[model samples]
Target chain A: MSREVILGDIREIMADVFDMDVDDVVVTPDTTADDIEEWDSLSHIRLIVAVERRFKVKFTNAEIERLRRVGDLVALVEAKQPA
Target chain B: MLKSLSWLRPAPGDFRDQARALRSEMRGGRGDDLGMRLYALANHALDENQLVSLARLAAGACDAGAAPAPFSAVKLGVFGDGTLSLIAPAIAGTALRHRLAVDTFVGEFNRAALDALDPSGPVRSAGLDMALIVSDARVLGLDRPAASRAAADETVERAFGQVRRTVEGLRPSIGSAILVQTVAAPLEPLFGSYDRIEPGSPLSMTAAFNRRVADWAADGGVVLVDVAHLAECVGLEAWDDPGQWHAAKLGFAPSLLPVYADVVARAMAAVRGLSRKCLVLDLDNTLWGGVVGDDGLGGIVIGQGSATGEAHLAVQRMALALRARGVVLAVCSKNEEAAARAPFREHPDMLLREDHIAVFQANWTDKAANLRAIAETLNIGVDALVLLDDNPAERMQVRSELPLVGVPELPDDPALFPRMLAAAGYFEAVSVSKEDRARAEMYQANARRAAALSASADVGAYLASLEMACAIGPVSEMTRARVAQLVNKSNQFNLTTRRWSEGELAAAIRDPARHVAQVRLVDRFGDNGVIAVLIADKGPDAWAIDTWLMSCRVLGRRVEEACLAHLAGAARAAGARALIGRYIPSPRNAIVKDHYRNLGFALEDESGGATTWRLDLDRFVAPALEMTVADGFLAPENAAA
Candidate 1:
């Protein structure tokens, strides 16, 4: 998926998981965990679970730890996509 | 007009004198006489108009001598019609009252109630400790049989809906609990209905009202007290009879007053998280008359045609009812296992069989030891047990040894045994779910599964043979109750002890901005109902998991691993790059302390008791499990995402 499509999907997932409005999710490349109240530590696992299920892919502990910002996440998904 | 006055004549002079003494005792001498005088005036009022007049008079009288404001307390708002005004003085005098309103429409009443308690609202909103809504049944027009029952139900629903919405909206603002009182209507025949209604029958209507009202209360996270149920149990007609209207004429019965007070008090306790979960019974004296060793299985007083036998039968029936409501029942006795098994096998009148009990400890051991063993066997904390024994010595032993277990003082009178047990407040659920009735059977089946697993060498082979299938989707209205049950009760695998009611869960699903999923697990063992719940919110290039918890019984079978893999795949398909996992450690969740670590997530940071972990979608691999996803289980939208 393209970066724009990836951002939209992430926004939808964040809205569904955090019980927040979709508009509340700002899919900026610089956005971090501090930007959302619902994006806590436990929710991190849930996000991983949702992402893996959506893309039919999985991540190692090291890769997951390195993903800190929206830009990083987009890069990881792009690299993982079937080419 | 005559309706209000007819309530005063039953109290004789002696009763009036006693009531005055009680009021004075409660008031601690200062303004006691003034309170009594005002109370008498209100009681003597002849009609609704007169009652309102006397209530206003009482309010003015109390306001004249109101105590100086305390430094730290939230001002509560009490709302009701005329009847509420009559009782306002009693609640206001003792409770911290910031403001009080006599009557308003349901919507406006709740708004004002919230405002009066809000810190930002007018009256310099102090924290509201509680809001008491005490309307009269006349307001709903239930006194007239010609009135539409449907309309009455709708009015009650609407009124409670407003109260619930207000409570929910204000919960985050005030951070205080809310309590509600049901309108008490006169017990009059509805024309074609039975002329003389039994105390138990009214519970049907009261239960209906309670269920309806609880829908809103649960949504708002408010606590509700069904005074009508308590009143019926203690005989409502006996006190509400036309003869005993006035406090000066017929005083409130001390016996009935305690029962009513106890209901409210217990409800308050439940609000503070002080409810018991287990019911422990002594086999010999409690379940039957004679010891099984002495009387033998055939001779023990458990079958029909005897008084003690009948009493034992009644206790069994009550136990079954308690078990049906999710109260775990266990035997903590000093009898041979064979002897205990014989009664359940041979007795015809036994209402509770071996299958009904989640744990059975009939070995020759200390009662306390037996209780601990039973708790461990059932996977529950010992503190949740409520021990009941006929022998005072045994009860005392358990009380002193295991202070955590609630030892209800059993009555000496055999006839009052059932009543006393009923009053001991066990199995009190805010609302019962379909899963509750099937809980004991499920536990029994789990026990069998445990045994089977113990006997088998290959755990994976055992799991594979069971043929487990998972049905995953967004929770609908029908499954909301089950979803809430899993969220509230499942502790071990739960990342966060986040408890949500049915209404709240429903609201979350209806909101478009969230992705909520519930996993239903069923295997050869049995249906685990909604065993797992996963709530997530979409963020920039990732879906954040809000809550991920599964029933502990379904653990060790790689179910959580399967669920995690499913969530990660779903998130990636939605174009999210990385998956995030979190661990919020609780006192009871140490078993899952390394869950994220085992799932191959790397810790990002740690704060307090919570730790954050993340996984990149590119490198993540789903754990292999011997399970199948039921066809057409995923929602089309979720599939697309």
Candidate 2:
């Protein structure tokens, strides 16, 4: 999947899991902990779990924390996406 | 207690004339002399006449305004002699005004005015909001003469009875939300009574009265404020001057006001339906004494001996009480799972076992991170948490980082720990149903079931051999307590966590549109009393499963399938079309992650974890299982003739 597709999928999962609007999940590199009210350390893990299950890709805990923005999550997903 | 209204810059007469006109309007048919007499009484600093005038003015205002805003919030009516009078001013909100209408009338004449107000007239017509009858704290004063004791009790009961009658009569007008404060009897020998009684006494008669009031409100489907408990926690003496029953009527110390304000605020919150859902506890110093890591499980102080052990026992006891009151207890500790499991397994005196906790997070991580895992496991919101921990630093970290969670201050002294913990208001449930009492055991039983499933290759064969006996009964008087318990506490299995006390549950069972069934499952493990609840509203030739939740412990046993089959049979008998199942996702109930979908219900909608499923009753086949159907367990009311 492309970065946009991964970000879209991430946004859909975040919206569903956190009970937020899909539009609320802005795909930007600058997005961090301050970006989403629901995106805490725990939710970050859950988001990773959801993303891994959705995209069928896994990220390390260090990589998980480093993926601060929607773009970062998309990048991690793209990097790990099966060829 | 006298406040000269004349001291105001505008002069008292300016307001007096307006009050006189309102009084005249209220008593138009009566003679001017009578009106002037009432007016003079108001002018001569009579609170009774002034209250009459105020009531009339309020009635007139309501009569002139729009149906009094439909009192769309929880209302609390405060019927107290003086303590409530002090607390009322500190509370400001529509909920306060709607719920707590103070009767500032004084003396015998005040009672006469209240009595004289025609129940059929504008006083009732004004749609006076809910009432919380607060008993006079002075009645409980130890310094009161012996003769006054009986009189005080009589007075308190009489006042409560009068308010009860008024509320009973105003049921249709008020719409059934009356919270009465159980009067906390004044500590005897007011000046030195604080020292006379042992700390942490099983609440005074006043506290008991408040508890009864809470019971009454719960029974009446109204909100209850446990003032006695709240007051006792903050030190009753702190709110009042020594020897004086009522706090200084005017200009109360700011430090003292917050405690009273909190009581009122909590009361209003409950009345408005704002309550915490889960209590997330730290296991080490919080649940029991000594670290599980260093104590090696055997060294932990849980059962008896020193005050440390007793304190831990007390906390466990309190936690059990909380669970009984519908507060889901979850563990979020940084300890090895096996080490943590040891105490729950071996410690005989451990107040809380593994079963009492709905979810356990025993891992090595930041405490907040563990809490998050627990939240995810349970499928509940972080905001719905009351985090309890002994370490101030940990508590502060959670407090600052997770602003939504309620982090209570921990006491430095291990002895004062339980009392401090109880003051957090984590489990301020108005009523405890029978289902609540068995909750921890059921959850613990579920853990056993989980273990069994992990060991077994054939889950179906294991479920069949467990010899599960399901008894489906229509809710009746005997099962009312359990039914109400399920209604309030069954969040995960619950379609909607709509809480109803026993009385309300009984009433709902009688409603033609609504159908409620209690499911009791007993297997080789033990009797899990009425562990499942099904609530649905009847549609045109069909039933909508408003709520279908089974205790998580009963999950793998195919109990959900059995319950659905039973309900489908009932629907078919009732000549219904389809059985609609709803799966509303809560933060903690993810165990039922694919509940409706697994049950073969066609998905109608899936928005934000709120999923709806519909199954045609005709096509839906009950899974064949060799389970015993218990006879005579059917509710007597719902049993076929």
Candidate 3:
């Protein structure tokens, strides 16, 4: 899967977790936790769990901790997915 | 209204879609109506994530000051060795399913010991009715490998001492009860398969610790949240998420939070005397493999020799087990009563007999109405009955009509029936006394007495034929737990409906100003153990009836009249001028709205749906009753005789 597709999927999952409309969940490579008011540590963990479930992939503890932006989640999902 | 209710099966639509719709509906000024809808939605089988969403909605409702009635609110103090902030919302949301509204105070993380030990800590100062200490193996240091077998045994002892101190310290400081959780062992084993025998290993140490905690809790009358057993059921590997634990100090996997919250809430419900009492079963496709009306008794599948037959037998065995543990069984089948009776009477493979059922209603009528009749006959609230049916349509109809009645949806396979019913946690009991073992038999005898009452000429002759004998004594240690259970559970017949714990009852019993009576009745049918409990505040002028409650099973037997006669004589002998009584109306206790009035007490005052009554001793007339009475506590002269 392409990075764009992964980011789109992550955006939908984040919308559900944050209880927001998909249109309001606009995300780009530069989007960070600070950009969303509901993206606290708890919701971040929820987001990671939901994203993993959506993509059928697992994230390492290091990868989960190192995630800093929407781009990082997309890159991780892309790397885990089969080419 | 809850249009549909299903538990074991997946809910109708995607939970997110349902939750979002409910959330929007909540914002539309329909908070109270939508709040119950939300509760019904949350009662479905949902995962942790869905539970979190629903919890958010519930928290929002609370913030908006939307109050849901008929759910008793419990003030809870949650102290844990790990991060419990995530669990607080889950518990608040899940408790709604169990008919409880939990107001929580989550203590400082890893500060359970300090919070419990400190006199004015957050937990103690919160004035909580109950406190739950959540922990895993790490809380007791059992996560680490011990040096030697003797050291491991010593570790268990030390852990037990710490727990004992915490519970005892918090008991006196808290409002009512304490709940301690058993630690789940770590999944990773140092000795592999040999961990079972290796005493110093993490697995063995946790096993020893749990055993010690269970025994201690039983002896101390402290309720237990058995996380160790819950973990084992969910599988240790799935239960433990080392990544999340290291990240946020989560006790277990976040995925299991819904299940964990449910277990804890049910334990709280059991301690609060909110557990259900009856298991109302259906006939076709539920108790047996085939419909008895259509297939006949010979063609129906039950008992051994085949998989379907064995599955049906397992359902019967489950019902029998529940019956053995004080859960009354009743049948609500839509068939001819004769047809339903044929199997239980003559089927060779049938395990349950007609004698086992407390109220057998098998006529072709609406199940919701029949369920109401069953609850009436059994003398319990409709909420105390759980309907186990295989038809989804019938389950939905009952849910819409009588939402209080518990209906657990069955899976398509009959083999999973017992497991589904067990998972519902309807009959979650805290303690089982000898009285509990004989409760089903007592209820059956009550049915027989009812039959005999109808057969007799009049109420006088019925009482005469009963040959009833009564014994009343002080509330002693032997009767404390049962009395407390009745005090908390008896809703319809209770006058004051005051829920007093065993400790409170003990203190009351020791007080010079209080007279506590534990009444037991015996008739030709069987032993009705401790059917009535009365607590009166003694005064020089008059004795005030503080708590007066009776088992509804003994209603219409003139037992209440016998009790009043005994109390009147005891009070007069104690130099009291008169007796005072109060009637407080509850949703379920309208049956006793005119209780004091019917007993010939003059109404003194009325306010806020409660009325006070006074009866002068000089004018009191003790009516002649058929039963013989003995009052050894208040009338000590009778004891000496």
User: Which candidate achieves the best lDDT against the true structure?
Assistant: 3
Say which candidate scores most in TM-score. 3
Q: Can you tell me the DockQ of model 2?
A: 0.01
DockQ of 3: 0.50
TM-score of each: 0.63, 0.56, 0.91
Chain B superposition TM-score per model: 0.70, 0.61, 0.91
lDDT of 2 by residue, B439-534 (tens): 555555554565666687887777876778877777767777656655655556556555565666777889988878778878877777777878
Question: Which portions of model 2 miss their true places by more than 4 Å?
Answer: A1-83, B1-131, B134-157, B173-177, B186-224, B229-236, B241-254, B264-363, B373-387, B400-406, B451-467, B488-501, B507-516, B534-561, B574-641
Task: Sort all candidates by TM-score, best to worst.
Answer: 3, 1, 2
Model 1, residue B630: C-alpha shift (Å): 3.9
Q: Residues A1-83, candidate 2: write the lDDT tens digits.
A: 67767666777767644435456466465666687786664345445545766776655546754665677777777888777
Model 1, residue B316: C-alpha shift (Å):
1.5
- Ordered from best to worst lDDT, the candidate numbers read 3, 1, 2
lDDT for B598 in candidate 3 is 91
Candidate 3 lDDT for residue B21: 81
Clashes of 2: 22
The CAPRI classification for model 1 reads as incorrect
